[model samples]
Target: MSSIPELLAVTNLNELSINDFIALLLTVADKTDLHPALKEGLPEYFSGGEKLREMAGNLRQLRDAAATGNREAKAEKMAAWEAGKLAVAMNAQHLTMLSLHRKDPSLLNNIGLELKQRQQGGKSSVNVLAETPVVTAKHVQGPSGPVSGSIVVVISRAKNTIPFEMQMTDDPSNESSWSSQGIHQKSRIEYQELEPAKRLYFRVRYHIDGKTSQWSPTANIIVL
Candidate 1:
């Protein structure tokens, strides 16, 4: 355990050094359960740190608040903690966008569609799909040959019937490596064909009223 003086030494948010920022993110990544897409992409943003001692110490305040038996204070602290976790996720997304934009500006296009939609005069659609959709894949026969089969998307909390897109990739580590299969009305798409012994990875995104959600966590299948 680090001493109080050591923990207090962490740079404040406004004064965060590059190392400190990385440390903070690394710490959060280790401690919290995050959206699967964020979980897979965030680690590449920073490297060479196992923990953020100062941030860890700060989290102890949450524990203390919970122990105090003050309902209001505990609720407030927990809410702040939840907000902080979200901030981390959003921050990671921003950094990734910047990097992708630098490599290929078009890659960042539609990356923050939901946020952009909110800024563009408010939500145009009554439906809001904030949660990342989960996708699955299966192998089946096609008219021409064997296909990677179709992708099935499940959006658990969607309020409206909306169009969804499928992104296919062979390299999971490279976000830019994906090829979009475009949008469709139904929840399933059967357009992808695969060679024998090849693997296909799939992710789905919802698009409604000119806005889209981030791609979901990947699902994969092998063509027999």
Candidate 2:
């Protein structure tokens, strides 16, 4: 754990393997500028949020180079990405922590984070592990008053769990149809911009001390 609540205490790059979590960190950092109360006390880490988005862009470039066999750029892009991915994620987290201290911690929900979390030095769970994670969720409202089409996914976590992945698919029959929502550090994640009135399927899997769990059973919800 970090000595200061404002500091993010991640020790390894793998802790931020999911670009979604990086994305989540960005959502909080960038939105602070719009939060009337928080805009006045923005933390320096939000600057890291800008850098994180750039890192994500580089990651996509690396993927493109790898996919198209653009050998000339792969090494260059990969090296730069490796040099900054963890810093970007951790810095965003660190800055958000400081911002939270200046405002209501409840803002965590507004930013898609659950207030209760454990991976960061909280008490460890001792129950025997399930073979796969079980996912549950509720839809969130839009800013104006109607349904927002956002899904807040929740999962039970064990002490061994490090981070988890969330994915969605409309065609469950096709193995190749699944689209990833990216990696998230916490179990309670929000799914955004889903098509209305369509059946959406979701699943989760966890990474432990370098091992991965089997994918969870499908959990489906009909968008409002």
Candidate 3:
């Protein structure tokens, strides 16, 4: 049996056939209990495959439509392509979780919990700008009445100076509405005076040197 990392690399290459992909998915799903690494990564791992399959289906449809030069079909295919890209991203995240699980099972619970909270907290809905590196707020606490505490953003890449832009958001989809911080140095972003009982959303976009990096999964902070 291929090791999980090997399988992940294969998936990354997009070389696996549909049947092979499905088989791997089934293997991961069925044998998660046996592999401690997989077990630890289960939450993220399991969530990825269906999305991959959906993306594959979309690509197939798009290819066919393109060959036929059907305008309406092309438009639909483009939409599917966009959705598929998101699905592939979710799968990539699962792969990252798996990698972390192999390094330390103890982190599995913590990482899983973080991922779950982010999903619940509305960060997952944000558009990921790139795969180079990502920063996300793990937790935020403010004063009892009207003070925003420190904002923590997790960086996925090797530690380095990653420039980021962050601004408050109410509409997650309105990326433009988010004010940019203008290439600040650091992975985590912070703001103050965000009052209690108010819901604050933030859109963060970051880059290294010139290449674009992953944006923070849209994060919401509620002061209490």
Q: Which candidate comes out best when scored by TM-score?
A: 2
Per-residue lDDT of model 2, residues 33-83, tens digit only = 444544454465444335555665566556546546688676875676555
- Model 3 residue 113 CA deviation (Å) reads 39
How accurate locally, in lDDT, is each candidate? 0.48, 0.56, 0.44
Off by over 4 Å in 2: 1-130, 141-146
- Candidate 2 local lDDT, residue 10: 36
Show the lowest summed lDDT stretch of 10 residues, model 3: 110-119
Output the lDDT of residue 174, model 2. 61
Question: TM-score, each model?
Answer: 0.39, 0.41, 0.33
RMSD of 1: 16.3
Superior by TM-score: candidate 1 or candidate 2: 2
lDDT, model 2, position 188: 80
Cα misplacement distance, residue 3 of candidate 1 (Å): 60
Highest lDDT: which candidate?
A: 2
Residue-level error in angstroms, candidate 2, position 111:
28
lDDT of residue 195 for candidate 3: 54
Q: What are the clash counts of all predictions, listed in order?
A: 0, 0, 1
